[model samples]
Target: MDPGGRVNIFVDTFAWFTDPAHYTGSNAVQVRVFEHLELSALAVLIAAAIALPIGLYLGHTGRLAFIALNVANVGRALPSLALLAFALPIAFSLGLGLGFWPTLISLIPLALPPIMTNAYVGIRGVDRDVIEAARGMGLSEPGILRTVEAPLALPLILSGLRTASVNVVATATLGALVAGGGLGRYIVDGLALQEYDRLFAGALLVATLAILVEVAFGRFEARAVSPGLRSPADAL
Candidate 1:
């Protein structure tokens, strides 16, 4: 084969996406990819459900703020792969099995920090005068939170969600380490077989997917923060 012909081999790996003979286009790949996406989404959603409320409470009360902030910091400091390795044994012990749940558990710590930090910062960043004005208008604490503070903080909170979502999507590739299933399967297998073309295909697919999700979430976030506001400053 000529140089160009040889290069074509690497490019042709993407054809596996449509090739029934390869795992990438087979049922196993479909099942694994879907499972990985579902697990990542579920973990992030759960983390958001828990983190947002706590963050808001800490931001508003100005109590336990340090604790919440430090927890997020520590979470960010921990390496994701190390956490995954650690969770593997624990998950097996708990009878959650060795595959999906353990991998999902590892991703939670990776996903939480951005959501919590952004939520806390967003709420706390709201103007004190606006908060006082809400109180002056006889708005209850919850009312202030719902109508005043949350509205102001919405943009920042969404920003955090956007960050968290992207992080989870990228990190979810590690799921394959535990046989939890994802595009990572191709990468690991490719490395084992010395198949650079297959590895490249997996990496390309992952990057493309991550970018697409990030862009989609960013648009959704923009809408969530402000239905009418088109610009960041206006949303804030």
Candidate 2:
């Protein structure tokens, strides 16, 4: 409300993080952090698995161009909280119970768009001249994709992974709203009990995790890009 109150929340958040009591139990900060990572990782992995193949195949063949481009748009059109809310009823009717499944399902969409779109765009963005060169060298369709296109597309594909990872990490906070675990628990419970420090601490943790993922992926993408493709089409 006031400047003093905001300052107090900051001070209290620092204290909350330093308190040993928050680090040793089932509900410890480390435990919640792990759960948060676990949920985010699984959702991203699943989304990638589903999106990558489809995106790559469509991009390689240059087929279904409309679907490839539009699917991500559709996913983005849906809100994360709305998706989570929509998932709850179906999860119950399917006997999946609460917590993990619904949250996981909702997070998958949050991750899907960037990954699928990037994969599609990256592959399509690969120099057509390169693809023709691969074909001229007697490389088959799969070989062209594996040896030429995918390698060239690596930086962008990894960019997608980076985006998806950060997104999932940030949005997985919604899991707590559905009785799931994670740092989000701190946010939800803190707000419920009017413990502003815990709320701030949770928000800080989510932001930190998201930033770490962004940095890690950025470095990995740099090292992971194909060396020859590092230059412009002039070399091609």
Candidate 3:
């Protein structure tokens, strides 16, 4: 398309967003935004559930620390697209089809590294003197980990979750590659039909969603964190 045509198409697409016709159906941008957030939320929840406990245990025990570190590094090093492609066949063979399961599985890896690394690093970064002080107070190991270590590590842990959430939300756009749905629907369909208008719209929505997620989390982190731990910038 010519520059003028592309510009016109972009304007037209932005205009479409304000039209009720574009948002009243199941496939509307409004609906797709919900679907996209649902997938991203599920992926983040699953990754956090799987990664956090192991990371905390390893960090606290000082055993199998290498394994926890390696798991995070491996997750970081893996390619998200390649991971999706590789899982597709196995998921298909298992009758999972080309939909939610396969796509979410791909996003898990994209999310795991940050959560795992942050959990481990956060816990380990807890001062040993503090741990000793807790122990001296007759705190059990579990008590120390729960009350002393975890609280102190909360900031880094949150930072990790934020990173994973952002990555998963952004990469969730790739769901369209395997017949899955999300905000990526617009981008995929636009590209197939040479609709630069809808393509730019989808890109805009995805970027906006990511920024919103970051801001929401930043606010939550600020509130959830203890006043003593709040940095100057994070202080309300």
Q: Which is the leading candidate under TM-score?
A: 2
Cα lDDT tens digits for candidate 1, 107-201: 88887888988888988998899899989989999999998888888888888887887888888888777877777777877787987777767
List, residue by residue over 73-185, the lDDT tens digit for candidate 2.
78888999999999999889989888888999999988888888888899999989979988998999999988888888888899988999998999999999999999999
Candidate 3 residue-wise lDDT, 1-236, digit = tens: 58987778878887867767768777798888998999999999999999899888888988888866886788789888898997798788889999688999899988888998898989999999989999999999999999989999999999999999999989998888888889998899889998777888899999999999999999999888888786777666
- How far does residue 126 in candidate 1 sit from its true spot (Å)? 0.6
Ranked by TM-score, the better of candidates 1 and 3 is: 3
Which residue pairs collide in model 1, if any?
none
Best by lDDT: 2
Select the stronger candidate by lDDT from 1 and 2.
2
lDDT over C-alpha atoms for residue 17 of model 2: 90
lDDT, model 3, position 89 = 88
Off by over 4 Å in 3: 1-6, 231-236
After best superposition, candidate 2 residue 153: deviation in angstroms?
0.6
Error of 2 at 163 (Å): 0.7
Every candidate's lDDT: 0.80, 0.90, 0.89
Scored by lDDT, model 3 comes in at 0.89
Range of the 10 consecutive residues with the lowest summed lDDT in candidate 1: 23-32
Candidate 3 TM-score to native: 0.93
